[model samples]
Target: MEKPLMIALDFPDLDQVRQFLAQFEQTDQLTVKIGMELFYHYGPAVVTTIKQADCDIFLDLKLFDIPHTVEKAMEQLGALGVDYVTVHTLGGFQMLQAAKKGLSDGAKRAGLPKPHLLGVTELTSISEQVLKEQQNCRLDMNNQVVSLAKLAKDSGCDGVITSALELSDLVKSVGTDFEYVVPGIRMHQDAAGDQNRVATPKDARKDGASAIVVGRPITQSNDPEHTYQRYLKSWTLK
Candidate 1:
């Protein structure tokens, strides 16, 4: 299967990553996602070690901050040579522009291919009510995602990280230019965990997700390799 499976390595310890990869031994078939937990522990060494193993990686730090700060951080992160990285769409236009500039300059300096910069629209864990009451946003769930997705594209992002539930609409809004990297994909029978919105792997593919970010479903399963392969087969099917 040629579908990209970004295994969300949300594990806190680097050893857990090593154990998981050792057990699976299918690095070529799957890309790794280094989120807050793993990156905080092993830092760039985690990205470096995974690259040395010949596995594509997504640095899922979801960078957010002032324009210069986020830009500076991206400059340093680009040195790791991962396949992709993320920034929050809520960071606004100038911030996103700064990030793009940083990535371009850093990649040129390091003589490596530029990483795909994705924007995180809204985490699937948060609901529309919270976004309205707490975050003080009046936009409904779908509109909220659409608004941020447009902002991401206008700000020069290659893609946006959204839940599968809104991916189809986001695709319609943004057309074919921007990529929709959907997360919060769970099997029909699996527990939804912290995710408030989700779709099954097959549903996500059917909804036009360019890539699916799966975490606990495969990582926490007893037979992760089989589970992973099942998803790969499912995504490959026409």
Candidate 2:
């Protein structure tokens, strides 16, 4: 998408999505994320609804399974013609390859442009403590994210969904050829909520993030359109 910010529509059902988007316009050229909750409940029909609004879609299911199974599922998702899709980078090289293949094959068959495949690295909600104790990894937070990012590139994925705090290392290690999408964004006044590695949109931009994902700050705002425009200005202004 031309815009660098994508809103995460974390709403539960189609009605809420329709209502939220009604505040904006087709000219907004908005890019939105349809996460597991929305997709799992509404299925592909939600994609059709989002499309009707003339916005770009990032289908963030973060698919992780056996290669063949993920591949088949991606075939269906690709046919929806969304702008981006995600798989877990921990799923390893062969699975990433299968995801790319499945998406391409499905898009080609349906005569649609293939969506970019982004691998989800360690989630921003995860802290170093969680990385060490819960996941039992020897490398520190940055190392693990970079490792997974390298694997994504080697596996032929287009980009990675990672945290803003880790962006500098990724840009250096993974380089400019890959897209670095940062989430868990929050303003200085906003509560951290469940996220541990949150950053402001300006921090993401200065760190060289290709895009940023914003949720509640915009979605739950009292005046969502005004809030969105504020964020858009913040994101674009130098």
Candidate 3:
């Protein structure tokens, strides 16, 4: 599969998604992400719509639940034929295994390729202080990310979704073959917004990230296509 630059479609409704994607009508083979906002609003049917448009979907539901619940949910999500999906590594070994099993079973039933199961290590919005104070995590940020990434790999996940800041350490700990789908990507001039740990596309590439998820920098730009092309160039040129 091609290394993807996933554009997070963080719109509130289907029409806004349509409007956003319309800008890329001439550009085929896009890898787009459908996060909770649009997924909850439109359900699985949005996947079909995006498929029809010839775009690959990375369904970013960030599933975190009991093993049974996550398994059943993965079953349903896998059947949608999305290219990727995410689950929280914090869910533990049994849950990750169950999720993987469900994805396989669902894909087998539907005769579709199983989506890449990405385990989320931590949200970019979270800080080391926040993690220690609120979640009672004892390790520093890099150690915590590496630890969760190791658990994800051991429990059958295909890769991990982590901040670009953690990519180098994660690769060192988990090995280079492990997929690192990084979020919190922003250009130097862009605002950080809610994300605390951010990196430029060039930085993510240097850190050996497999892919990067970019949100407002592209979607909210005055020239979305130009910004998208810039990001693509940043990854492709070096």
Candidate 4:
């Protein structure tokens, strides 16, 4: 599988997304993530529009629900022909298995390939202190992430969306074939924003991340196309 550098289209609306993507040449293809903020506002039509532009989509809603509900939702999303979709590992083993089945069934029905089902371990904005104090999680942050990765893999997920800070440890625990789709990647000079645990693109690649999802550093840059190319180069050559 290609280790794609995914640009998170975190814009509030489709217009902003269009304006930002307009910087790239029409023939240039990109792997993009459409998260809740934009998707919720425009629904699946946003995904269709991006698909029409020949971009691979990673729908990052991080679905967490009852097993049947999540399964049904995955079935619907699979028909969208997205390259990847996220499900919260906290949904447990049964839900994970059901989601996998739903995606496969949906893809078969739609005559498209199954999308990669990525489990979300934990949000990058969460810190050790927050985990222990607010979430009442007793294990350390790394342990908690590894534990989730194990569950995700054992339940049949193809990969996990984790912070780059934990990618190396997760790979050690789950083995390399279990894809590490890392987010919270910041450039050396960029602000971390709400994400507490962040890594640079080169560091993420060095840590053995299968792919990295970048948002603000590229999307909010003064020159989005230039910044995106810089990130892509770092992932490819570093």
User: Residue by residue across 1-238, what tens digits does model 1's lDDT show?
Assistant: 2358788987878777778888776576668888888788878888888886678889999999999999999898776798889999999999998998888778878999889999999999989889999999988989999999999899999999999888788878898777888888887788999999988778888888888888898889898898888877676577
Which residue pairs show backbone clashes in model 3?
none
Model 2, residue 111: displacement in angstroms?
0.3
Judged by whole-model lDDT over C-alpha atoms, candidate 4 comes out at: 0.91
In model 4, the worst 10-residue window by lDDT is 20-29
- Which digits, one per residue and each the tens of the lDDT, describe model 3 over residues 23-70? 874546688999998888889989988887888889999899999999
What TM-score would candidate 3 get against the native? Answer: 0.98
Question: Which ranges in model 1 have alpha carbons more than 4 Å from their true place?
Answer: none
Better of 1 and 3 by TM-score: 3
**TM-scores for every candidate against the unseen true structure:** 0.96, 0.98, 0.98, 0.97
TM-score of 2: 0.98
Off by over 4 Å in 2: none
Cα lDDT tens digits, model 2, 44-71, are: 9999988988888999999999999999
